[model samples]
Target: METLFWLEDSIVGMTVSSTQWGYPIVLSLHAIGMGTLVGVALMLTIRVLGFAPAIPVTSMAPYWRVALGGFFLNLLSGSALFCGNASELFFNWAFRIKIVLVLVGLALTWWLVQICVKRSDQISPAHRILAALAMVTWLSAIIFGRLIGYWS
Candidate 1:
């Protein structure tokens, strides 16, 4: 309780919550990061599921750097956002679900990436299943995140 209050009272939190432009800027960056991270992952997942047979799965490995960049961006921005409302968000069911989904989605994505990078040939059935799970997990995370504001 004390820690949450301190976080909410921190400089980063105050800036994000008090300044009109601050929240918008941070929220926009979060959105951009989410789009970059999820968009690239979705593309790779689709390709692995046999959507674009022309593009080699191995070639998609290079795009992981873009996803990593977005991940870092989100890490920074999300921390700030959370600090701004630490006490309330900490108890929010939607926020908790979103965090769990993000973790699961990240793990699934990493596993899929390893398979894609190691095997230059066709993706195995198991790997395709992992990709599908990652897709669903990430999309669920997004939906839950969006629901946080409206959730009681």
Candidate 2:
């Protein structure tokens, strides 16, 4: 598409593709963001599933801010990376699957968070199921994202 070509040829794309440090730095940041986001989600999901009954679920609520920060970081860095190779990525099956998984994971995460926050004292089986689903979805998204590098 013309738009993809334009984005790939844009200044941001040029910097990411041309500069020696640009791609690495942005990619590293993306990884850090993914770790931060997924780590928090996993921790929260574990807690919600009653792994650490000693710790209150309400305490985990604040970590959502950290997850949100990581999401924004990923959004920005991912955008830059995509701009660098929009044409290739746009048609990449792995990339498309990753995007869908991310969306579903985010929805599940939000639902899990709401359950945790609203019923901190009582985690129903449904809540646990949601938390497990969120964990799996997030992990799958990460896997698909990694596959993008080798998907060709």
Candidate 3:
């Protein structure tokens, strides 16, 4: 656990010490990636929950894959963005809340993927509830994260 945090710290350190434009560029991409991941995830989850019963559930799974790719891209971008301001992020109250919310959002998504998707062998009706919750939580997380930049 400590090693993982250390790795994150190292990445953040590199970005922080890099040129100013580098930070902004990575941050922009991170925001874009977040939008892609969250948007697609919400859409797919909603489809699973029966909101879009006309849509094939398995076909919708592919969108989640696309979302996973965006998530990885965001991981890279987020690393650079954080690396550019490691110390500040570590100290920011809003940033901390944002991180916690992100964790919760991820956990909820994972839970839905396993319980609703795996058990049903397709998206379950329960997915609608999970999707709605995910949207709210993820949107709040992103908004709070953006707010940190503005306030700081």
38-77: candidate 2 lDDT, tens digit per residue: 8989998988888989888888888988998998899999
Alpha-carbon deviation at 91 in model 1, angstroms: 0.3
Candidate 3 all-Cα RMSD? 4.1
The residue-level lDDT of candidate 3 at 4 comes to 43
Q: Point to the candidate with the largest TM-score.
A: 1
Question: Compared to the true structure, candidate 3 yields what TM-score?
Answer: 0.75
Which stretches of model 2 miss by more than 4 angstroms?
A: none
Each model's lDDT = 0.90, 0.90, 0.71
lDDT by residue for model 3 over 1-152, one digit each (tens)? 45445645684656545567766777778878888888876775666556767765555555667777778888788766666666666678888888888778877877776666555555544666787787788888888987887665
Q: Which clashing pairs does model 1 show? A: none
Candidate with better TM-score, 1 vs 3: 1
TM-score of each prediction: 0.97, 0.96, 0.75
Question: Backbone collision count in every prediction?
Answer: 0, 0, 5
